[model samples]
Structure formats: C-alpha cells, structure tokens
Target: MPRQPLVRPGRKLGAVALDVSSSHRAWLDPTRETYLASGRTLGELGDRIPLAKSKLSELLRGVGLYPRWEVIHRLAAELDMPSWPLHRLWRQAALDAGKAPEWIDRSTRASAATARRRPPLDHDGLRQLVEHDYRFYAQVFLCDDERDIAVQDTFAALWLRWDTALCSPDIRAFAWSILRATVMARATYRDGRPELEAAVFDTVALQTQISPSAGAARMTRLVELFRAISRLPVTQLDTMVLLHLCGFTAERASGLLGVPLAAVRADERRAMRHLESAVTLKPDTEGPIT
Candidate 1:
C-alpha cells in the first residue's frame, strides 16, 4: 500500500498557528542570532510596533522565531538596531549605491504566490461596525469619493455578498471608513433632491434605520446632525467617523488609531460641542423648509 500524508489541524481564524517543521525552525535561527547582536526582547519590540503582544508572538512563532532569541532578532530588525541592521544598511546602500536588496526580486515573486491566501480584515470588528452605527454606511461611501452612483453600486454589492466570514474586526474598521464616505456622498446627493431637504434623511435611508415614511420631523433632526457634521473641518473627520458613525467607543477608537484614549475622548467631546453649537430646533407646528 502507498504511504498516506498526514493532515494537520488548522489554527483559529485571525491567528497564526505554530509551524512545527524543522526547516522553519532553522530559518528562524539566523533571525534569532541577529537580535542577540542588537540586544532587545521580543516583548520590547512588540511595545514599539503596532501589534499586540500575542499577535507579535504569533508572527514570530509561526515563522519558527519563537522561544526568545528569534523574537529579539526580529525586534532588532524591525527597529533597525545593530546585528540585524544589515537589512537597513542594505536598504540604504541600495538607495545610495543605486541598487536594490539581493532578495527583493526573489521575495516579491515568492510573496505574490502566498499573498492571495491571506484573509482581508479581522471578522469580529466588522460585525461590530455593522451592528452599532448606521454611520458606517456613510464612511464607506466617503472612501469611494462621496459619489452617489459609486456608493450605491458598492453598497448594493456588499449587501448582496454579506457573510459571517466577512465580519473580522479589522475588516469592519476598514469598511467603516468606506461606509462613511459612501453615506456622506449619498447624503450630498439627497440634499439636492427635490423630495429631500437634508442629508440626515438620506443618511437614515442609507442605513435603513427607519421606514421611508418616518416623517419629516424625525428626518429634520437627522438633518440637523448632518449640518453640524458639515461645519467641522476635514482634519477632524476621522475622529467623527470613528466616534459617531462607526460607533467605536473612545478607548477602542484610540487603540485602533494608536493614539491615547484621552485624545479620542477629547476629540469626541470637541466634535459634539461643535454639533451642539450648530443645531437649531424648529417649531413643532411649522412646516419643514422646502
């Protein structure tokens, strides 16, 4: 009888499982040695980089760099410290000497083969974005340049393609921006429509939060919010997108942006203050501005 190949269990989604191959371990040793030359820990390297500790650890271990030495080497390389600074020197030399890294061409070819296998964005975060705010629809629209036709086309596509695997947290965050842009553009279009007076009604309709017949008064309040948003500067748009539309808490938004939580909170407050100053209540008995 012919010998049978063994099938290994897969790692949990959003995480890299350890590769127990001997060749993988061998490849990581040199990287480990490089770190020893630079003198830093993997945990220390993780602190300076964008990854969380567990993720950093996983990135190292999956490539057979775990067990300390390999971690340190990657840190040194990531930080451009000595020992593994050869990579940096090579980059600089390539620039100064009018050449490229020796592995660049080869690596690019190899990377292209594996690139398609990777997932797009984290799943859990994506679900949260959809669950929390209708504002996300606007953000996504904006990324595509706030064009109604484009936004609607994209939304129609995503709405049709919705699935559980598409709900990663990272993917959700990414989509949040796109949705915001898309909704904003749609809102802009609605503002100019003969039947609609404010972007809020458009935004609400974009999210499907209420029926089309939700009444002019409710839509007017939504319009008031949009007006306040419009008065804010473009520089603060990211904060507004994350805090208001995406419905990310201050802490989570801060973590996602790699800024201090206080900064996120302060920006949220500032955005709200600006909105409060901009809104004006119309009399209940009065008709909406046509």
Candidate 2:
C-alpha cells in the first residue's frame, strides 16, 4: 500500500520530459492495452499491487520518474501477461528517458560490474547487424576511435541486456533502439536537434567547378535540405540516411534496418513529404528528394 520511494538515485521529482519519445510510448502502450482488456479498475489493480491509487495512476500514464522494472514486473504478473517483452520495452524507454547506465544495469540479470560477461545467443549475427548500421550512421558525426568506442559501447549495452533483446516482441526494433541511443548520446546537436551538416555533402552535392552564382544557389538548396533532414525523427532520418545518402536500395535498406519492406518505404515517403514541404529547391516539386 505504501508507494515505493517516489524518487530514486539519479531520478528526481522533476526531471526533464524524456519520457515522450516514441520508444517510451511503445514501451507502455501494450501494458495499458492489456490492463484495459482485463477490465480491472485502477483501485482493484492498485490494491493487488499494494500501491496507492494515485501512484498507480502515474505509473500507468508513464508520468513522473520512469517506473521501476520491479513494479512493472509485478503489474504484468498481476495482469496475467508475460513480462519479458515488457521488460525489454521498458529498458528501451528507460534509456530514452535518460536513466543512467548503472541504474539500468540494476534491473537486469547482473550489475554493471558483471553485465558484459553474459553475451546472448547469435552474438556474432546481432553484432554484425548492429555494427554495420552504426558505422554507416555514426560516420555522419563521429570519426576514428570515437566511432569504434561508440560501437563498442553499443554492443556492451546489448550484452548487458541480451536476454531482454531475445525476449522482445521485436528484437530488431529493440536492438535498433539501443544503437540509436548510443549514437545520439554522442552526436553533435544544433539548437537541441541533431546537427546533420556533415551529411549534406555526402551523396548529392554541387559540381566542384561551377560559376559562383550557380554554386551559391545550389549550396543554398543543400542547406535547406540539410536543415529539414536534421529535424526529422530518427526513424525517418535513419531511412533517409540509408536510402538517399548511403545509396542503398529500398530492399537493401529493409534488410539493413531489420524492418519490413513496407516500413522502409513508408519511412521514405514520410521523409520525402517533409522535405518537399520544407524546401523549394529549384522551384520544382517533382525533383528528386535525395
């Protein structure tokens, strides 16, 4: 009946709004659906969990500090749903919510000290999948040893939570989330958004030898596209990077991203739509987005 400590080490009463990421919403949405399906009143569930109704409301709504995995485990058992998937989803959301790595380690099979010892199955395959995607994307922002450390840290985090990765409803999405978090943590940002200026010069830049007037015009268009692309959600941004900048075919991108073919196309469409609306390059709406 007593609310577990409302504040924990590294999590204060009024931290910034990190819980609004799509990853966090996906993490909590299933539990909400299952709880609703069970048709149980908040009072009833609260009583079973032995937490105050007010505290229960916050957890269900994903308000305040991130919910402890212990509480989520209890809630899942009480609801008669498997907790493993939720456990994986919860940690994805936690990373997005700015939970410290040490804190995340506590909710897993081992503490940070021993977490890296237990690598999950298909270690090589998973590592290659993640490493390839990371290197290509991270090259946009990181270089040399920086990129290597970023990749190393990503795999280390994966090793720590490989069980959860395996149990997730979508292992690909879960692993991708970890990679995104790792790279974004160290990426350069402009005005609080990812600074993707490095990418502007990657695939589609102006001719090296052009008249000053024409070059200036082309450079302006590139900057416009750059700003728009930089502001995209990471989901669409990843797709754009692969399909446009890296020149991967959509099928190849689907394979590389470990998402459905439809998902890859949908991301491409959404990103292109945003680009078209945001930039009037060459005064041609029919021009290529890439």
lDDT of 1 by residue, 189-235 (tens): 33442112233334433344546676877666766655556556542
Q: What lDDT is obtained when candidate 2 is compared to the true structure?
A: 0.65
- TM per candidate: 0.33, 0.55
| C-alpha lDDT of residue 111 in model 2 | 20
Per-residue accuracy of model 2 over 35-97 as CA lDDT, tens digit each: 655556667777987787778777777777777776777777787654544565567668767
Show how many residue pairs clash in every candidate, following the order shown.
31, 1
lDDT of each: 0.43, 0.65
Top candidate, metric lDDT: 2
- TM for candidate 2 is 0.55
**Model 2 regions more than 4 Å off:** 1-118, 202-214, 283-290
Candidate 1: regions farther than 4 A off: 1-212, 281-290
**RMSD of candidate 2 to true structure, Å:** 9.9
lDDT of 1: 0.43
